[model samples]
Target: MHLLRPLPQYLVSRYHGWVATSYAENSAWYRRLADDGQRPRAMVISCCDSRVHVTSIFGADSGEFFIHRNIANLVPPYAPDGLQHGTSAAVEYAVTALKVAHLIVVGHTSCGGVAGCHAMCSGQAPELEEKSSFVGRWMDILRPGYERVKDLPADQQVAALEREAVLVSIENLMGFPFVKAAVEGEQLSLHGLVHDIRAGTLEQAEDGGRRWTRV
Candidate 1:
């Protein structure tokens, strides 16, 4: 908390400027949104990395997408424990309450989470048990993906691993009964997208022989 004081003031000032402009440009809509409720068409699961912003990437308005961000943008398989699960809860709310029509999992290149997973798998980083850190635990979700494509060339391996993680999250989405029902009923569509930050392009995972291609 002590480390964030300086930045918080700057951010608050910037946000005030944005708020002033937003009220001026869309005062009526803003008032209605504040009084009424949000009805987003899609829900996007994205990384919490400062560089990856779903709203900016999609050019969406405030209530366009119900967004959930986490380390590496992971979605664990549905579980009904007493523990609070942020990503799963968001998914539930988006699909059940908001009734969003689409759920998009966005994975970006050069993700620290992915790199950490790679490092752990390669024994470059300390073992999970030894570290006992949040990142280490969070990255456990991507272990299967890391193992699946560990044999490829360094560059290709990272891309494959990242894509694999995206697919895994999509599979995890299916673990939720509501998500499954929505998709099966043709009310919801699930998409896995990979964003090449350096290239400033998006790649949609495809079926058959073809793989990630620019969108």
Candidate 2:
């Protein structure tokens, strides 16, 4: 078998510099976090896209937010059928174990996952429809979200579906029994936000989805 190479030496050197500077400067805080463990007040589920910047946008420090990132930032319906569900496991841990006070689902514009779902559902990306296609199967969670925006013009559907993805995730998050109970008991709050990647703006779903006001 052919082995892959490690990160370039320049990247490794940069990491070492960061450790000697940033790590050394904040070593006390890092040590305290290790000793006390994490007690984050909110759990943020965002997209795997590198530009989402949940921490930078919120000015959050390490250990302040429990973050879980997945393609297109989706939450599948609650299913305890003994399948390997990574996203579900994260939600279970954050909600049941960590007892986070808030759960936020953040979707962003120009999401490749959302675009692929549009293509697959719209017959533009047939490869994703294959039974062995893991991405298509994982993106099935957003199929309903696609349906919500499929009626728009071809050029406009992707962005609309992006917003729907957030709505769908927020809806699916409630499907978990414990999450529902926690919300009803006033122990947890749910939020849906969409990031405008190019404009550097955020819009929030409000008035029970009647409108999305800029945040």
Candidate 3:
């Protein structure tokens, strides 16, 4: 806490403004949510990109979607090593506790994390391969995805990997015992999507992942 810096006064004021206006207008719903607890129907795993607003894109309100974010929105295969796993923990809670019916992985264009992984896998980013590189190790989950796209040109490879990231997450999500069970029982459905930043378009992958169609 000592190392933390105070947030800007402008942002603090803006938050207070929203609390007084939007929060006040929706006070009843807010109180109901707080009292009854959240039972979101869907879980969205997305990148920690400021540009990609999951709720805004989905027209979702509070208590509608359980959202978890991480670099490149990648999900690692279930290891269950009795170690701390933030993403996996979120997925477990969403599926078991929240009982979310849909689990969606959202990838995006112009993703810095994906680009970095592409660079690292292509041997263009030696720094990320260092033993002390936490990000590098975290991104190792996507190495299999990189292998699928490694043969393409640099530009195409980045895009391919970006799309592949979504597929990889879907594949990894099945690695979770609970997720796999829910999915097999038809209680949970898995989805993959990509957001085009410049075009402001959203695309959903076909059932077979053969193509992406605008949604």
TM-score against native, each model: 0.91, 0.95, 0.96
Alpha carbon lDDT at 9, candidate 1 = 79
RMSD vs true structure, all candidates: 2.4, 1.4, 1.3
* lDDT-better candidate, 1 vs 3: 3
State residue 80's C-alpha deviation in candidate 1, in Å: 1.5
lDDT tens digits, residue span 111-166, model 1? 98888888888788886536568788888888888888888887788778778778
After superposition, the stretches of candidate 1 with alpha carbons farther than 4 Å from their true spots are 1-9, 208-210
Name the lDDT value of residue 180 in candidate 2.
Answer: 97
lDDT of 3 by residue, 74-179 (tens): 9999998999999999999999999999999999999999999999998999999998998899889999999989888866999999999999999999999999
Counted clashes in each candidate structure: 0, 0, 0
Q: What is the lDDT of residue 96 in candidate 1?
A: 96
> Among these predicted structures, which one has the highest TM-score?
3
RMSD of 2: 1.4
Q: Per-residue lDDT tens digits of candidate 2, residues 1-215?
A: 87998999999999999999989999999999999999999999999999999999999988989999999999999999999999999999999999999999999999999999999999999999999999999899999988878888978999889988889898998999999999999999999999999999999999766589999
The most accurate candidate by lDDT is 3
Assess each prediction's global lDDT (C-alpha) against the native: 0.86, 0.93, 0.95
**What is the lDDT ranking, best to worst?**
3, 2, 1
